[model samples]
Target: MKKILVVGLFLIFACGSESKAQAPDAVKKTFQAKYPGENDPDWHQDDHGYFEAHFKIDGIKYRADFNADGSWVETETSIKKKDLPKAIKDVIKDKYGSEDISEIEKVDSASKGVFYDVEFKQKGKNKDVEFKADGTIIG
Candidate 1:
């Protein structure tokens, strides 16, 4: 009984630590260099193996993603519907005027450049749509 209890406890602790793994030193340094003076970032590993740092700047929440080798992948911040670009707003008004926007995020990425992620609830399910600055749908 004692042996079994100890093994169970050990497994629990090991699994917990794995889930709470810290970001690599290189990633931390890169983050500091990019956003100096901003501290207290909560780090997590995303599904794509990227290190994501959740923090706020000037009271605006931001999530910055960095590669394990310290390369910046992207940074995103939530924005209001009214804050969207005029072209995007027009497109949404024309196509999805009836549907309410659930959330909006402005993403700046290294590969795909800058884009907006707009989410809407359709048929009791959430759907995300990506758009470029010119209101062209990318995905």
Candidate 2:
């Protein structure tokens, strides 16, 4: 009985300690303000020392990054190909009709407007395309 109690206490402490290892209070507050109901999210420090939150809403997965000062940097979310704009789909089909789309992510940043990053595979080549919300290609 004593061993079981000790194990239980250790497990609780370990779980709680993991949350304490998350980003700073400022970052958490910023994330909370940005995504009000998304209280529980996976967090990690990026290469640039920013905090990244991985969460899901309405069945869509998203990642929001906050800088050290708690400023929102950017956000990315996966999108379905069928949901893409008609012009964007037309362009992709015209350019790489033979390729298979592997992934499509919509990214919004403070420095740039909303855009989609599409990753596709063609034969033996892998490529990525960027498209603005207006369905215009941007490199």
- For each candidate in the order shown, give its overall lDDT on alpha carbons: 0.90, 0.85
C-alpha positional error of residue 132 in candidate 2 after TM-score superposition, expressed in Å: 0.8
TM-score per candidate, in order? 0.82, 0.76
Candidate 1 similarity to native, TM-score:
0.82
How far off is residue 51 in model 2, in Å?
A: 1.3
Clashing residue pairs in candidate 1, if any?
none
Window of ten residues with lowest summed lDDT in model 1: 12-21
lDDT, residue 26, candidate 2: 94
Residue 33's lDDT within candidate 1 is: 95
State the lDDT of candidate 2 residue by residue for 57-91, as single tens digits.
Answer: 99889988888888999999988999888889988
Q: Relative to the unseen true structure, what is the Cα RMSD of model 2?
A: 5.9
User: Which candidate wins on TM-score?
Assistant: 1
